[model samples]
Target: MRIGLDIGGTKIDAVAVAPTGQTVDRVRVPTGFGAEQVVANTLQVIDALRGRTGTTPTAVGIGIPGLIDHETGWVRHAVNLGLSEVALGPLVAEHVGLPVQVENDVNVAALGAAQAMHLDGAHAYLNIGTGLAAGIVVDRRLWRGARGNAGEVGHIPVLADGPPCVCGQRGCLETVASGSALAAAWPGHPGTTATEVFDSADAGDPAATAVRDRFVAGVASAVRILVVTVDVDSVVIGGGLAALGERLLLPLRADFDEAARSSPFVASLGLSSRVLLAPLDQPLAALGAAHLAPESAVTTA
Candidate 1:
């Protein structure tokens, strides 16, 4: 058996997958702060999942939010998670009596999405959630930088002098294009989430329409950077904001179509449909963590 955990800002989900990669048991629990509680919750879920099956998993993997240092299993920093400098992998491994592999939540999802596409060799996966992040894959492997922090498409500067981002940067793609940005831009509106913004956009409200358009432009602007910087043939867009479907993608495609006319990098390459939805069900982070576990049967190259 293979155990996979998806650790998030507020919740932790764990699943036991059979050797064939089919989920056989699952458990969900609220995530606690600090190193001790996080591991406790994870153990709680793992024990429950294992209890249901009365079998020990061969290995465990986790897809975790925030910036994780893959080499040392240290969480360098993650504001939303209220954690920094916590060594996660060794702690979990020691506590659970199993080998543990950790991966960035976004990168895991990207890998899972790419695996679904069968587009090995090279690809880029962008996930637009509370914020924006991308996962770059090189020849079927995740390209983590020295600190395991790569594919951070959110921090790239987009607007010269725009609103301040939670990351302490101004005019970042995430501040303008992410679900949090949409929720912030229209606080007085009836709804409190990105889904509400889409309903308003679909209803043709002017303020909502303006907010939607600006966010889409930010997305397009970011994609332009990703496509040029990484030179990937396909870009997959997923996460909470992508639930808007064409509300986000159509405008982005139009923007890309117009911008590529003057761009050098994209002129020689074929961008596949500009934006494609990620196929990982129930979010990719935890599932991707499952993929990183030693027992995962990754499709062959």
Candidate 2:
């Protein structure tokens, strides 16, 4: 059996998958902030998942939400978690009495999305949650890029003088398109979440509607970047805003269509139809983690 864990900002999800690609057990627990608590919570979930199956996991994979060094097995930086540098692989392996593989959560989710959806040829998984990023898969193989930061599109500048990003840059895609950005831009109600912003737009609130429109444009821009740069066979959309479902897709599709109609170059790319929704039936990152072991069938390479 192989075990996979997705350590996110709000929750820790775990799953055990048999050699046949069937999940035998799964568990979820609230994520603890900071390094020590996060590790403890992750270990707890692993133990619980193992206990449910009454079998030892042959390999374990963990998806972390930050900058990770594949060679050093250390998390270089996790801005949201306030984690600077930590040896997550060694610590988890020591506690679990087994070897562990660690990778960025979005990258693993891309792997999971590709496997679950059985995408062919080149594919990209766009994660528009608290931040914006993408994971690329070429010919069913993951392309992590040099330094394992291949898909850091959130920092890509889109607007010349838009909002500021945590990375100390102005007009980054993350500042305009991510869930965090939506919440930050919401002017109708204080502490309103991204989902509520979508809801407010549905209710016909002008301010909320404007924010929603801007968000849609930003997201459409992100999609265009992937379509033009990599021209993947498919682009899978996932992450927190996914819960908005059709409300999100409608505007995104509209924006893409508008762009295509105006520019023959855009229409030839066929970017609108290439965009797809990621499967939400399972925790993608965790499932991708299950396939992370070097010897596992779902290899990232």
The global C-alpha lDDT for each of the candidates, from Candidate 1 onward, is 0.74, 0.83
By summed lDDT, the worst window of 10 consecutive residues in model 2 runs over: 292-301
Superposed Cα deviation of residue 153, candidate 1 (Å): 1.8
Measured with C-alpha atoms, the lDDT of residue 277 in candidate 2 is: 89
Worst 10 residues of 1 by lDDT: 292-301
Candidate 1 TM-score versus the reference: 0.84
Instruction: Give the CA lDDT, 0 to 100, for residue 71 in model 2.
Output: 56
Q: Candidate 1 lDDT, tens digit per residue, 116-221?
A: 5666766778888888988987765677766555678898777799889877989888998888888889885433567677678889898888888888887776
- The residue pairs in collision within model 1 are 6-286
Clashes of each: 1, 0
Task: Report the number of the highest-lDDT candidate.
Answer: 2
lDDT per residue as tens, model 2, 90-112: 77777777768888899889888
Error at 265, model 2, angstroms: 2.3
Model 1 spans > 4 angstroms off? 78-82, 189-191, 260-268, 272-274, 293-301
lDDT of 2 at 256: 80
